[model samples]
Every structure is written in C-alpha cells, then in structure tokens.
Target: GSSGSSGQALASDSEEADEVPEWLREGEFVTVGAHKTGVVRYVGPADFQEGTWVGVELDLPSGKNDGSIGGKQYFRCNPGYGLLVRPSRVRRATSGPSSG
Candidate 1:
C-alpha cells in the first residue's frame, strides 16, 4: 500500500478539481484547492489589484492568512482564517450540514 506510484496517482486525481461555475456567488460555502472549506465573503476585483479574487472566511482555524492583502482589508475575518483565491480554485460545498 505504501507505494510511490500510488501517491503519484492520487496527485493526478486532485488536479482534476472542478472549476467554479458562473452561478457561484459570494456568501456561498465552498472548498478551496484540495480541502480548505470556507464561506465566500467577497467576490470582486481587489482595490490594490486587478483581476477578480474571492475572499473566504475559512472554516479551519489555521486555514489562511489575515483578511488583509498588502495591509488593506479586502474582507474581514479572524487572523489565520481568511484567504483570497481565484474562483477557479473553489468548488461548491454541500449546501447543508452533514448528518454524521
């Protein structure tokens, strides 16, 4: 079970992460990259930059950096629990809480 090729296969599986659909909007819950889950707080062009960014209030305690980028507030959240990522990096999360 501890084989190198299997690890490589797993890596490729993750590379197929689904793109964010056009209907996805801020305030929706989503998972970023592989396993970071958060609520989208802001979805627009940042003040100090061009291109769109999605500001997420991460569910994990150490999920991300503070909500500031270059010392400006793009969105607000506790330190180590905010992240700005391209919408492409996000995927829709379950709409309701898990039963288990």
Candidate 2:
C-alpha cells in the first residue's frame, strides 16, 4: 500500500492567507488626488451582507475637472473592481488641504 499522505495531501491555510493582502486599518488615510490619489480607509473583514472591503467615503470636489464630481459620495472596493465610485465618469478629488 502507498503512503496515505502521498495521494491525499492537504495544503496549509496559512500559506493562502499570506498571499492575500491584509485589510486596511481604521484611521489610515489615503490621498485621492492628481499625484498620490486614492487613500485606503476602514480596513476590516469583508462585509457579510455586501461581501466587500469597507473603504473610504469620498467627498467629491466641485465641477468636472479631474475625473470626479463635485459632491459627497461613498465607495466600496474589492480586489477585482478596485474603487467602485458611483458616477464612474467623474474624476478623483484634487490633492490639497480640505476646506472643511
């Protein structure tokens, strides 16, 4: 008889976990602008309901200049879709000190 482990082997879950990027930590900020655009915020386990990684809530700047609308909005990102902001036609916010 052949070794039972030879044909029926198991892979370690730790190896797989290592390959995945750790979720973003809370309070961490990402810059969504011309140069250093898009920041990561609220990193946590995938939402059971939405099945997404909780990300930053965007407040779009006024007018269509870069690629973002001039208003406030929310976004949810995953490994495949990246940043899925509503009104994808709009540009990202400008890089500067926020007015508020």
Candidate 3:
C-alpha cells in the first residue's frame, strides 16, 4: 500500500512584488518622501522604469500623474495625485492606533 499527495504552487506574474516588503500592499497607508502620506495603489515593476515601484495616491495634489505614465496606467486616482517611487522611499505610516 502507498499514499500519494499533490501540492500546488501559486506563481506570481511579477517577481518584483516579492522583493518589496510584505507589509507594503495595496490600500495600505504609507508615507512618501518625508512629509507626505498616501495609500498604496500599486506595488510592482513599471514599464517606464527598472526595479520595483510603489504607486501611491497622495492626499495632496502634488503628485506627478494620475497613476499612469507613458500611456500606461498602473493605478487610477485623481489628477496630480498619483506618484510612482522606489519601494525604498516608501514605508508604512505609523499613524495607526498601534503606534506608541
């Protein structure tokens, strides 16, 4: 007698996504640069740039675009509210109740 089992592996389209921190995800509130806060809209590679990029919808209208660049839309947001920056420049905001 013998027993057999099969395991499945989920493959992600973008390997770059794994390179970014697991805590950084879409809809998660994050801080960009030094004094700006926004929600994570997209976390992956951009066709226009190399490495991983984080698309955020800033609360202020100081971003460069509305989540699109070079005719490609990474995410949707109000005009001038979308920005794509390296994952290194983004971090989870500590404004939540968990902050001490």
Candidate 4:
C-alpha cells in the first residue's frame, strides 16, 4: 500500500515533467561505496529539495556483530571509482549483470 502510493506519486511527478530522465526510474540501482564503512541505503527524489541523483546515508556501526565497527560513518559518491559511479558507469553495469 505504501509502495503503491509512493509509486503513484512518482508517476504523477513524472507526468508533470517535460522529460523523464532515466536515473529517476524505479529498480535503478547505484552502487555507492561507503566513504567510511557503515550501513548504506537508497534515497529517493523526495529526500532532496532539488536533485535527480540518489544518495546513500551511512549510520555508525553498532557494536552488535552486524558487520560494522561502531563509529560515525560518512557517505559520498565518487565518480570513476568503486561504487560512487557515474550515470554512464551505471548504464554499463546494468547492461550485463552477469558479466563480472
């Protein structure tokens, strides 16, 4: 229900747009490496005041064997390296999931 509602909202926004960009579509994944090791997740257009690119938010690793060290973690996107990939890189990665 929540997902459906969100999807509808996104659709409505897209309809209002003059052009639909490829990065805003659902199921689009960007592998952004942690600037400092921590939990990582996706952000949607709603998360930002203005921007099309999604970002990762890192939480400090809790000392509970969750596979992280407890501390303040930071997140960022670095083009041309690792998970902080550019749109062209994402397109290349998506073109063949099983290639590498």
For TM-score, the strongest prediction is: 3
The candidate that wins on lDDT is: 3
**TM-scores for every predicted model:** 0.68, 0.25, 0.76, 0.23
> How many collisions between residues are there in candidate 3?
0
Q: Please provide, for model 3 over 1-100, each residue's C-alpha lDDT reduced to its tens digit, 9 standing for 90 to 100.
A: 8776665564567644436888999999999999889999998888986777999999999899999999999999999999999887898898648734
User: Tens-digit lDDT track for model 1 on 29-95?
Assistant: 8988888888998888777755568889999875567788887887888999999887788788977
lDDT score of residue 50 within candidate 2: 26
Q: Sorted on lDDT, highest at the top, how do the candidates line up?
A: 3, 1, 2, 4
Reference-based lDDT, residue 58, model 1: 94
User: What are the lDDT figures for the candidates, one per model?
Assistant: 0.78, 0.35, 0.89, 0.30
Where is model 1 poorest over a 10-residue stretch in terms of lDDT?
A: 9-18
Clashes of each: 0, 11, 0, 0
Better of 1 and 4 by lDDT: 1
Residue pairs in candidate 1 whose N, alpha carbon or C atoms collide under 3 angstroms: none
Candidate 4 Cα errors over 4 Å, as ranges: 1-20, 33-49, 53-92, 95-100
Candidate 3 at 68: error in angstroms? Answer: 0.4
Candidate 2, TM-score vs. the true structure?
A: 0.25
- Tens-place lDDT digits, model 2, residues 1-100: 7655556443565322312133233333444334333444434333232223434433443212232122322333332323322221223344468788
Q: Worst 10-residue stretch by lDDT in candidate 2?
A: 61-70
Higher-lDDT candidate of 1 and 2: 1
Give the winner by lDDT: 2 or 4: 2
